[model samples]
Target: MKDTHKHQGLRNQLVKIISEKGITDKNVLNAIAAVPRHLFMDSGFVDFAYQDKAFPIAADQTISQPYTVAFQTQLLAIKPNQKILEIGTGSGYQTAVLIEIGAKVYTIERQLELFKKTKFFLPKLHYKPKKMVFGDGYKGLPEEAPFDGIIVTAGAPIVPNALLAQLKIGGKLVIPIGDEVQIMTLFVRNSEKDFEKHELGEFRFVPMLKEKN
Candidate 1:
């Protein structure tokens, strides 16, 4: 749990790398600088944490690659205090990044082991989400309807209509859609019935699975 000076230096290096790769949002980069990326993984692999690559975590999940997180977040154009629903809460790393940039996050994790681990882990780092739920990601949190933005960390075979329905009109849904290799897709709700769609590019992610616990 110790975030040493070495760790901070590594994080700074990571920020520079992602910025060069085209993450222009200052807030996003600042959030990247603020979160201790190394602390998100098992200590043995901490050396690779600042390399902008995805690494394995509990429950057979991989912490998303840094560029992928930054890309999806930059697309959302997060504003302070905006409500954001995150479909997967793998390492709680991305949630921490969102919190750093000032979005109020409500994250759901389907894997019980990772969910439990992250539930206790995030707050230890002092990154608290608005809500952390153990449930199916496909079924967005309807009770907390009308979020300003929604991000799905795992690759969905198809966009979950429930997620789109949960967005406020003018809200954005950033998800990766496909099988094997997912295309980063954005859906912006224009009106109650009109939503705009865009496919940015392809990235690989663990599959979004059904509820098991």
Candidate 2:
């Protein structure tokens, strides 16, 4: 529960490493520094929390690698107070990063165990999303439509049309698309029927399950 000076020093080293790797977004890097990522992992893995790697958590889910989180977040171009929808809450590390960056986030998780655990855990760290849901990521949060940005943390077979419809004009959706391996993809809503697509690079993520288990 305590974030010691040692933890802070480790986070600074991580920021420097990722910055050299081309993570130029200072806001994203600062958010990464502010969050106590060690608190989101199993105690046995805490020693590696700042290593920019992913580790297994409950429900067979892996907290996304820190570099991956920063990459997706940088693509979003998140602004303070922007309404952002996050798919896949995992260990809530990414959610904490989003909150630290000042986004009003609504996050959903399919795995009930993770959903329940994160819901109970985040607030204790004083990192809270606008809403935490137990539902299908493919469906998204339509009731909170027209988001400024939508970030999908898991890899999807294809981008969901529902997510497209939820984006406001000029908004962005950062998602990874593929099965065995994913191409980190971004879609910017240029108009009601127009989008600009860019494939950033390759990334591997747990598959985004269509239905909640």
Candidate 3:
């Protein structure tokens, strides 16, 4: 059974944090609240699951902060059953939240160890994504083109053209764009080859690098 109290505590903390930070999307909140974050982190760090902080996992990747997760999801403006693409799977925490929002998710993870670990934990957490690919995130999943929404967990110096090409017209993409410190970016496909870009705010995320393992 879902641990309602523990989950509720996390929800309450998220609401307080987002409200103070000016996040207004209730759907995003609901999704964040629904996913149990402790399941996504190391057992030693499970106690800090609800805190508004990023925590490290394997492969030098860290799960994004609660506010960032909620903020990015809000930017996507997800619709029920929308097909979504996630560039970095990491700990699969964001994917879990995306699934809670009813998105059919296709996530690509470059790190083999992280991918293998998550492949085990994801099913354990009941977050069986539509598809999981182990490949270079820069080259996205070409076979699964035309997504309704796309999210990149890692920060990149410039938005990859390939990822931009995968979005269907009217699709939304929320990514962090920069080399060092990134600004959260929202891209909406305006036409066949045009996009409307919105700079959300400054945020810090691990650099999006090709996985060595």
Backbone clash count, each prediction separately? 0, 0, 0
Summarize candidate 1's per-residue lDDT along 105-207 as a digit string, tens digits: 9999988889899999999999999999999999999999889999999989998889999999999999999999999999999999999999898899999
lDDT of each: 0.93, 0.94, 0.89
At residue 57, give the lDDT of candidate 2. 95
lDDT of 2 by residue, 1-213 (tens): 699999999999999988888899999999998999999999999999999898999998898889999999999999999999999999999999999999999999999989999999999999989999999999999999889999999989999999999999999999999999999999999999999999998999999997735
* TM-scores for candidates 1 onward, in order: 0.98, 0.98, 0.95
The C-alpha local distance difference test score for the whole of candidate 3 amounts to 0.89
Query: Across residues 108-188, which tens digit of lDDT does each residue of candidate 3 receive?
Result: 999999989998889887889999999889888889899999999999998988999999999988889998789999999
- Name the regions of candidate 2 deviating beyond 4 angstroms: none
In the order shown, the candidates' Cα RMSDs to the true structure are: 0.8, 0.8, 1.6
On the 0 to 100 scale, the lDDT of residue 83 in model 3 is: 95
- For candidate 2, the C-alpha RMSD (Å) to the true structure equals 0.8
Candidate 1 deviates by what RMSD?
0.8
